[model samples]
Every structure is written in C-alpha cells, then in structure tokens.
Target: MLNAGGTPNISGFLVDAFGKHLVALPGSQRALPGGTAAQPAQVKFAPEGDELLVTEKGTQLIDTFSVGFTGYASPPTPHASSGVTPFGFSITTRGYAIVSEAGSGSVSSYDVEDGKHLNSISAATPLGQSAPCWLVTTGDGSFAYTANAGSGTISSLRIAADGTLSLLSATAGRLSAPLDMALSSRSKFLYVREGNGAVSGFRVMPDGTLEPLGSVTGVPPGAQGIAAR
Candidate 1:
C-alpha cells in the first residue's frame, strides 16, 4: 500500500477474485484506525471504481481511496443508521447502495456515508417500508427489491436521491418467507426463493412493477438464495 494520509499496510495476503496468491506491494503498511485494531465486517475491492466499505457494530460505512486500495482521504462515511441489524448490502449499476436491515427487516438507501446516517428506509420513500432481508438491484440501478419475509412477500420500491424511496404502483404478489431474490442479467425478469421450497418468477415491467410469471415446477427444500445467467 502507498502512503498519503495514514501509512497503510495490509495484514492479510493479497489475492484476486479467484483467491489466487499474488505478491505483496513492497513495504506495504497495514490499514488501521488510530491506536485501535481495525475490525472489518466486509471488504470489497473497487478495481473499476475507487470506494470501499467496512461495517462495524450495526452501521455500514464508506472508505475512500486514492490510487489502489489504501487509507481513506479522511474517515469512513457512515452510510445508514437505525439499522436494527444489517445482514447484507448490494450496490446498483449506477453506484447507489441498497443496504439490508436484518433487525427491522428493511433495506436502507444511501448515496454516501458520513457520520450522520441517512433515512433507514430508502426505495420509493422513507418511513413507509418494512423488513427487507436482502436486496437485488437492476442493471440500471433505477429500482430494487427487498425480501419481506415477515409478510411472506417482496417489497418493490424505486430509489430516489438522498436515500429515499418512492413506492411504485402495483405491489407484487405474496411470497411466504421470502429471503432473497435475483434479477435477470438482461433486467427483464426476477426469481425469488420463498419459504416451503418454492421459487417464484416475475416479469419485470419497465415501470418497475412486477407481474408474476408463476413459480417454478419444484425445487429442493430449504431454498434460500438464487442467481440468474
């Protein structure tokens, strides 16, 4: 790691997407907080971009970079708050973030993370959404969905600036214990895994509304996650 602000040294081995071993940068410094051991819940590389995220406690934050993955220009940017428990997060094609709130079972939206946390519920609006176990963004990043397992369905919302959501017309049909979902690579379809080992498919409309395509014939039990080509 190169030095600009705080001297950063990677504590772990340098690896690529396939976990292949790679030689370390000469005389690298570990990235750490001032006088404290760094605790990172997650670490994602931004080869095409120049931003990083590290989750601590229940808050997810942003860490900026210079050239390569080094220390931040300043401190981390706190993306969201009121996260009863954040289990996971996903970024859209447009660079916006959809964070999973495991506690409230809702997903929060954020443009940037500072000390001040933005609205917890971000999609079509704020203070109107509910439990979102996980989220999947479209290729355009204009829309996203939350697996509302509490109500056994999915909550569809459109993302707005300042981490706000605008509820779109035509809510999707019911999904029992929906935990996760995936958008088609072409952004024309969605497949969700519901409780009781059922997979639901929906035709993604241009207006960000979902039209149920119907469930797959039969899947194995304990279906939890999915991906599409």
Candidate 2:
C-alpha cells in the first residue's frame, strides 16, 4: 500500500493477508519544479506496466515513478494548467493517462511513457458539466468517464486511436456531490458514491453511456469513499 503524507512524501507499506502491516519502506519526496511541495492527492499504477502516476493537487502537476518504484521523474514536458487543479487520474490500457481537472472542469490526456500532453476535453459550460473530481476508464481503454460534482452529473467520453478524448454524453447523475467512483471487473457496471450518503449504480452501455441502476439510501451521512471487486 502507498500512503500520501502531509509532508508531500509517499511511503510504501507491505501488508499481509490479514491487513496487518509487515514492513514500512522509506518515504520518497516528489521533486517538483521550483521545489514546490506538491501535496499528492491520488496515485494509480499503469494498466499494463510498473509505472505509477501521481496527481499533485497543490502544484497542479503529475509525477511519474520509475519502474520497480525506484525514483521520481518529472514529466519530460510541462503542462500549463492555467490555474487548473488536478485531483485524480487513471491510466489506460493503451499507455495513456487521463487526469481530472477540478479547477478547469476538464479532463486531459497524456502519453504515459513520455509524459507528453496529448489533448484535453472540456467537461464544463458548453458541455453542461463541472468540477470533474474523479475519472475512470474502461479495461479496453475505449472509453472514459468523469464524476462531475459541481453540476451533479457524469460525463462520458470516447478515447480515440491517438489518445484524444471526445465527449460522448453528459447526463444528470441525480446524486448530490458525487465524489468517487469505481468500475466492475468486466467494466459493465459503474458504482458512484455521493457526499450526501448515497451509493448509486449504473450499467455501462456499449457506446460509453450510463444507464441508471437506482441507488441505496440511508447510508451514513458524509460517506465519501467507494470501491468495487
């Protein structure tokens, strides 16, 4: 397991089956430009490789870890965020990474191998979506989805051959403050958790659209996390 610390360091932990920690590895500090402390908000491993991608909310940057988790490498290129804040990201099976920009209400794609920014799709205003805090992609890397908390909706997108994002559909989620999401193993179902203590499920369509599967109510209020098997 990897833990993001307040000091902007990442610590690795080895745990046994019983969920007990067996060993704690030395923490590694992310070297951001200008030596700014990038408070790492989320981390995801490459879908087909050993690389790890981390989102730095404070500095609005993405950092990659070398294979075998040895060292940190700043992206070969720089991404001008224009004040957009990156929160969560997911790597695709096709060696691409998609990051959710909360400040800009958009999702940007990048080449994972070289950290090259490819294209970005706006999920706000004209698209009728806002504040996309979390993102998830299909196992085949054909589609991607964002949980738009600001507009209480979800936006569906299609991944082109060259790793560009094309908005497919943006529909009202009918949930309050949808924060986090997860997908079923076969990528047929999507489960979302709302800040208002509700869990909603959806059936992913062939065209990357979402069909409501109702929701479970009465969950303890302030529930903010979710996962799937």
Which candidate's TM-score is highest?
2
lDDT of 1 by residue, 74-100 (tens): 333344344555544566544555666
Give all candidates' CA lDDT scores: 0.55, 0.70
> How far off is model 1, as Cα RMSD?
6.9
Summarize candidate 2's per-residue lDDT along 35-86 as a digit string, tens digits.
3466666876676546666677767766666545444433323344423678
Task: List TM-scores for all candidates, in order.
Answer: 0.64, 0.81
What lDDT score goes with residue 17 in model 1?
52
Residue 144 local lDDT, model 1: 74
TM-score for candidate 1, please give it.
Answer: 0.64
In model 2, the number of clashes is 0
The candidate scoring highest on lDDT is: 2
